[model samples]
Target: MSRLLLVVLLLANVGTAIGVVYARHLHRQSFIELARLEKTRDELNIEFGRLQLEQATVAESNRIDAIARTRLGMKFPEASDVVVIQP
Candidate 1:
């Protein structure tokens, strides 16, 4: 009976040790995944910032006017072509 009790205690200790190792492994994996996700998030943020800057640049009035004049062949009306209406 005493030997049996010793065997049981030894088995329980080994089980506990295995549980600890498994938990540590899971923790390390989770930490690595967290780091990877954070890196991806940072890269996306940088891209978002660049896109915002590009959008601002594209939306500028001077750039729009330049594109319209160059690409669309648009021009302002001559003064002689103006017809002013008194309201």
Candidate 2:
């Protein structure tokens, strides 16, 4: 009876150790995943900042006018080219 009790206690200790190892492994995996997610979030934040800057640049009316006049060679129509059509 004493030998059986000793064997059971040893088995329980071994089981508890295995559980601890498995728990540590899961904790490590979760930490690695959290790190990867944080990296991805940082990349997205950088891209969002870049896109916001691009939107601001594109939304500038003066910039559009400059591009239209200087690069596209657009000009205002002459008075004779304008027809006064009112509803």
Q: List the residue pairs that clash in candidate 1.
A: none
Q: Pick the candidate with the highest lDDT.
A: 1
Per-residue lDDT tens digits for candidate 2, residues 1-87, read 999999999999999999999999999999999999999999999999999999999989999999999999998899999999899
Report the lDDT of model 2 for residue 87.
Answer: 100
Q: Worst lDDT window (10 residues) for model 2?
A: 59-68
Worst ten-residue run, lDDT, model 1?
73-82
| Global lDDT of model 2 | 0.98
Count of clashes, each model:
0, 0
Residues 1-87, candidate 1: write the lDDT tens digits.
999999999999999999999999999999999999999999999999999999999999999999999999998999999999999
TM values, all candidates = 0.83, 0.83
Looking at model 2, the pairs that clash are none
